[model samples]
Target chain A: MEVKKSFEEINEKIKNGTAVVVTAEEIIDIVKEKGLDEATSHVDVVTTATFSPMCSSGAFLNFGHADPPIRMTKVLLNNVPAHAGLAAVDAYIGATETSFDRDIEYGGAHVICDLIAGKKIHLQATSPGTDCYPRKKIDTYITKDSINEAYLFNPRNCYQNYDAAINTSGRTLYTYMGVLQPNMANINYSTSGELSPLLNDPYLRTIGMGTKIFLAGAPGYVAWQGTQFITEVERGNNGVPTTSAATLAVIGDLKQMSCDYIQPAVFEKYGTSMFVGIGIPIPVLDKDMLMNLAVENKDIYTNIVDYSVGRRSKPSLGKVNYAQLRSGMVTLEGKQIPTTPLSSLSKARAIAQELKRWILTDKFTLQEPFKHFNKVSKLNTLEEVGKGEIDNE
Target chain B: MSKKAYKQRIYIEAEKCVECGACTAVCGAKALRLDKTTWKLIYNVQKCQGCMLCVSACPSRAIKSDIEDLPSAVAAAL
Candidate 1:
């Protein structure tokens, strides 16, 4: 039989304040020094993390019914439009939704951050009145405390891997990846390198649907596999994908979240977004998991893609590992270009440490996913149908 | 609020700043970026129009806004 540990066993140690927990970064040195066998046997949990701009993040809010309730047909939070297609007073504010009256500077991320900071938010809604619920329109203010429920329910986040970006065009390209300098003058990338949760468990062995995680400084749960949860992507020698891979949909209480972990960001001419800090503690279920946790920055690789093409299928420029990306420069076509890792590494390190402390102090417990994610293979595409004939010219 | 009416002043605490380029991404005035020589976050007070976007974009919370008392070097740059 193989050496293994159970969630019950880890929780028992956590309760007694005896579980040996380390971050994915710390596990590298521990394995390097003590050897994989000794390190795997000693470590009970390893936390992985990332604090990066997650564009597919949002919050669902349900304000309790008013005196004579109105079914909200349109909703706006602090001038930012929210999806009001849900129930009477419930709405989903996506992070990327820009303010109706302002530029990209103010948006759903600002509204979400204001709510998290306990600042008041301007709320406005319009509805076509009905007999039972006969209110026409509403204009009011709401804070996180004032709302009945405010939860961060992101559809896609924690991207397993993202290919670095470079521009081969004549002009600077303002993209979600960052400002790509013209003529391949700069290479832009975003990841916490080895500390990323999905990279640590590419196969989704220990991470599952019910897995408890630190989401935006709050204890949250993995809702499901995210929007583009592809598994059949190309991989490097280290078992990590070199392209965009698995993502996670996470849910947490917005009231319990802090502004520090959910900071807002604005990409010039692109849109508004937020830095979603997510940390997952991978319980050392077996030596295989521990070995996975011990993976380092050098082994993880990503490809540099040309963003100048402006298409779904951009051409791959070159294959580069995280080590080369982090070194601040990469050689593409016999020329060196400066690089920028757009994600906040300091915040990622802090989130990992915070998650480690949560487990060591017994505040968090490991959960084997209630159900393993559906092994989705092929992804479908939206077909464009023209009434007459498809024009290719 | 007139842009010229208010005298805006700001400073980024050097030791606490992480030079993550988050500020550079949001800065509309082109006042913030990591110095190519030292790779340290540099704020060109001369060029800063003081929209204060960097204050929120900074992950370390090192950027300060609306300071009445200004250092001589910062004032000179301004």
Candidate 2:
């Protein structure tokens, strides 16, 4: 199919409220009925979304300066420990970090959620007296309003594809994948089926550095390639990985975020995490991009792995498509195994629909990626360094 | 049926509470409050009316209740 509009022209159409925007959920049915050419010509943007519990997420907050401006060496937010190793007033609170009071019910993710919910959190910090900054201790209550800057600068957020976890052993397993029933009785998957952001842009064509995205509830950008991005994974005919592959590091202003999009989640056994709602708008640059966006649940595949193993490389039972997974049942060894998703499909749809409304109303505009992601980056496995071996590569 | 026909009470597990204040928001009886210092949910059984609204509103399944069977002597005495 010959392309008629450039990215700039599409932006012009978006500004004028003339661009045809549909969500990834809507485009599947559109493509099925109208074919790729007709769908590509009709749709100017495809909004993709996913609401999942991302454990490797955190927020960096600059609480401004205290009265005496203490160089905070140790920090705690609502009993949850935050990394105060940065500047005097800045700290980073990871999602999975538990409180110093050893409360499993609350964690860093809960603190971030409480702040977003417009609730005040107790902020306590300690520092030795310094020459320039003489304050030694600070104990106060802080809300989102009290902090000068509170932004989520997650090192990793969206995964291209992930594995469905099941336990084969006689005992149950408490993992980041959620609680898995023993003897492969139940499986837990964590993707939003077809509406996932990375799955929509399998090859990372429109999603890259400086790409504007709906993060949590605020407008954010792709900061960089996500940590532990395995780009060398096996791909299907459409260049979409069948297993774990690409990821995106994103950053967004926490002050602009809403509690509706970002929620604190506590797994029954896996502790605390954040259910981050992310939406990315893919500008239909060409027919190939349209086809990628048209990719459905049956086209995307992931492996069901046994999480009972204690090693990094677990045994994979077999491959399963998102369609089968989303059906809430998949056959494993001729037996029907019920499936549960850790991600919320309802929340994902809400985000996609919300983003679609934003684009349709000209409230949110599409952004051209400053640079496309590198395809040749290799993921290295972790290895223990031998003593007295100064290996320099 | 009278109000005393069924024995009811609200069970609040403070250990399971994340202090998100969702239960407090849904509690019409104002039985639940967050301790500002400890950031924990404080439940007053006297103020609770066994509405069970907080039980369903709790995201963490922290709140539960049991309906105790009253003895005939106790019911008659009351």
Candidate 3:
């Protein structure tokens, strides 16, 4: 018998979910080798990321009531599901929230999602400040000596200084609020020390209504465009240009989240009344491998499969465009590691099952199990977000 | 009881705006959008209930209102 797993088997695994973490660079490697489909044959991939200068773990640990982390993960995972055939995955947090607390540090990656989702209503200190309360001297950077001497010099005054610094940091400070492809591309270039398709072809306008972009981390640019068209830079899927199997894994994780959380709320908020923009990063797909897999699994519909493309990856066209093309958690392995690795497929299914249980559990007490919501006027026509229609015209 | 006067006025600075559309996104009165002729953001001030959501959501902080100018304008119009 062949050792390969079937779609149904893999689908079952995704229904139950967990943190299927990988890096974006790794997916590129997988595409170059396996062609994309074979590599992603099994997995539910999405981007769940945290920013640097901060550890994602510490942010989760400090989640005021521990609900922010759960709410954040739940929101990302709700975008992807196997049955609907939409690709979606949880982008992992790259760093902790503390790293973003520095003065002058406008904000970090995770904070961006919160900003878009309306979770984090206020912007905090990105850097620290100094003051001249007693002597009226200028206060600037935070130093090791200052850290050690804070208490010794004046404990109460130290609190005063820190509070003043924290408050002042938000004043007149500017940052990119949402996911901007160009900005994302720039950040990726600086971090990975590599050039990306998004930066080189900065003018490509790729977007589609079927895709809903998730910010794995905080505000990098202005704000979530909340509309489909981005002009100053490329549209969605602007940065990534590697055909890889790992992209499938990333899509799988993201799809699960799409179905579970984002679909309902985004549909409600952006629905029929107003236009909304989604900033998606593009991923490579091996057309041949994808065709073969579907052919091999003759029972699956091409339409469903095509729709599923929106899960972890984006189809290089449409108004819900791709931008700031940057990499996710997957590292640049020669044969890119599957974003939603076949091995980790079961983990995703488990998570999905747990989420279903939680949604039902909370429904009774909260009346609405979903957390991230916008109370827009009652003109909601979209039955679901990132699904509705593409209007291919 | 203390006597009080109610008024409303809206102002926008074009330079700072990025046109994120958050105002139109949440406007209960359907009074905001990018003006087609100039692409400058505009609003139907009359339809606005003064909820100030647009005022709050302006990412660029370019929107302002004149409480004093509104009542007189409304009274004069009436």
lDDT of 2 by residue, A1-393 (tens): 486567788888888889898899899999999888888888899999988878889999998887778999999999999999999999999988998675656898889988887899999999997988899999999999988989998888888989999899999676777666678877778887688998988888888899989999999999998988877788888778988888889999998898788877666556777778899999998899998998888988899999999997999999999889766579999989877666667677888998888888845887777888777556767788887765667
Deviation of model 3 at A351, angstroms: 45
Writing each residue's lDDT as its tens digit, candidate 3 over A244-317 gives 10010001121112211211101111111111111123221223322222211111111101111224332321
What DockQ does each prediction reach against the true complex?
Answer: 0.19, 0.05, 0.01
Candidate 3 segments exceeding 4 Å error:
A1-393, B1-7, B36-38, B66-78
True contacts kept of each: 0.16, 0.02, 0.00
Chain A superposition TM-score, candidate 2: 0.97
Query: Per-residue alpha-carbon lDDT of model 1 for B1-78, expressed as tens digits?
Result: 111112356766654454466567556566776654344566777888878866655544556677454455555655
lDDT of 1 by residue, A1-393 (tens): 466889999888888888999999899999899887788779999999998889999999997787779899999899999999999999999998999788688889889988999999999999999997799899999888888999999999999999899999999788888777688888878898899999999889988798999999999999999998998888876678888889999999999998768787777668888888999999888888888888887888888999999787899988898888877678899998777777777778889999998888745889989988877677876678877766566
Q: Is candidate 1 or 2 superior in TM-score?
A: 1
Q: Which of the two candidates, 1 or 3, achieves a greater DockQ against the reference?
A: 1
- Error of model 2, residue B73, in angstroms: 28
Q: Give all TM-scores, in the order shown.
A: 0.87, 0.84, 0.22
Best by DockQ: 1
Off by over 4 Å in 1: A386-393, B1-10, B13-19, B22-78
Residue A145 in model 2: lDDT: 93
**Candidate 2: misplaced stretches above 4 Å?**
B1-78
RMSD of each: 5.3, 8.9, 24.6
